[model samples]
Target: MRHGKTFGLSLFLLAAGTGGALAQATVVTPLQQQYITAYVAQNPVPAATYGSEFDPTVGAVVPETVVLNQFAVRQEENRNWDGGQDAVRSMLYFVTPTQQTVLVEPGTRRVVYVMR
Candidate 1:
């Protein structure tokens, strides 16, 4: 038990040290904030209802190939390739409020991605 505790502490410290090195504070101007707000508003999370309904294990899988395939499908559908072009028809990975990784459709805000 003691050894496990020590190992955990060491791992924590190592992670903390690394993260600290990359940590920097940034101040966003009012203009920047407004742009972000407008963007968020236009892309309103249609799937907000699925915000916390994701399976805890959903995020554990390797999403590389699947995610790429989805992206390709979207890109093919709309050659110009905008976020809304993909809309809410495809699957996407997202972090739930509970910190669980869940699959969702960002536009329509559904959890159907996980079950698929």
Candidate 2:
């Protein structure tokens, strides 16, 4: 009887732990979901490092044309860069010409992450 009780308690604890972990999962926004759908359609076979969460190799060039094409008038409203000297603390999402998804810091206008 003790063994059975211990097994049941163990199962309950395992279930509760897994449920909490899943509940804390990141919620992707609607725009991000849209970008994911489009990006996946083009990139069927993902690279080894694709969608890695800890990537720190965002390039320095944040092109005006790419930003203009994806974010049109929104960029004008979100232009918080003053003389382009400060580091961007906020993240913005963009889809590249080749259908790659990226997160960028608007204040610095540099790519901070890529999800491919």
Candidate 3:
């Protein structure tokens, strides 16, 4: 009976941890997508050339060697453009060779959004 209780508690803890991560995940709306696309278009950067093995997707970790740039706009402008979401404003960005704009979380270097 004690072993059963321990297992149940362990499962509950694991679910709670996973739920927290899911809650923190970003959900880009169509309006936000348009904003991102326009922002990238207005401030062009040279596309990065990573090997074929380095395909970037949402939630993928970008390599440390790859250069990431902050959004070119001023903080106030960025806040307005990103709908005042600090999470969106704080992301680092890079252009992929295929013309996709990838937004990465600064701390994790993980791709949060890939705007095609």
Candidate topping lDDT: 3
Least well predicted 10-residue stretch by lDDT in candidate 3 = 3-12
- Which residue runs does candidate 3 get wrong by more than 4 Å? 1-25, 75-82
Stretches of candidate 1 off by over 4 Å are: 1-18, 21-24, 46-116
Cα lDDT, all candidates: 0.32, 0.40, 0.64
In the range 28-112, model 3's lDDT, one tens digit per residue, is 5565567668777888888976777777976577898888988655666754653423444556889988888887767667776
lDDT of 3 at 66: 87
* TM-score of candidate 1 versus the correct structure, residues matched by position: 0.24
lDDT of 1 by residue, 1-116 (tens): 34334333433333354432221211223332333334334443422223233333411333332221122233344564333322222334443334333343333333322221
Error of 3 at 106 (Å): 0.6
Model 3 steric clash pairs: none
Q: Write the per-residue lDDT of candidate 2 for residues 1-116, one digit (tens) a residue.
A: 33334333433343354432332222333444453454346444332232323332354335554441232223542364222111111245555545565655454555544565
lDDT of 1: 0.32
Each model's TM-score, in the order given?
0.24, 0.33, 0.67
Off by over 4 Å in 2: 1-57, 68-89
* Candidate 3 TM-score, true structure as reference: 0.67
- The number of clashing residue pairs in each candidate reads 3, 0, 0
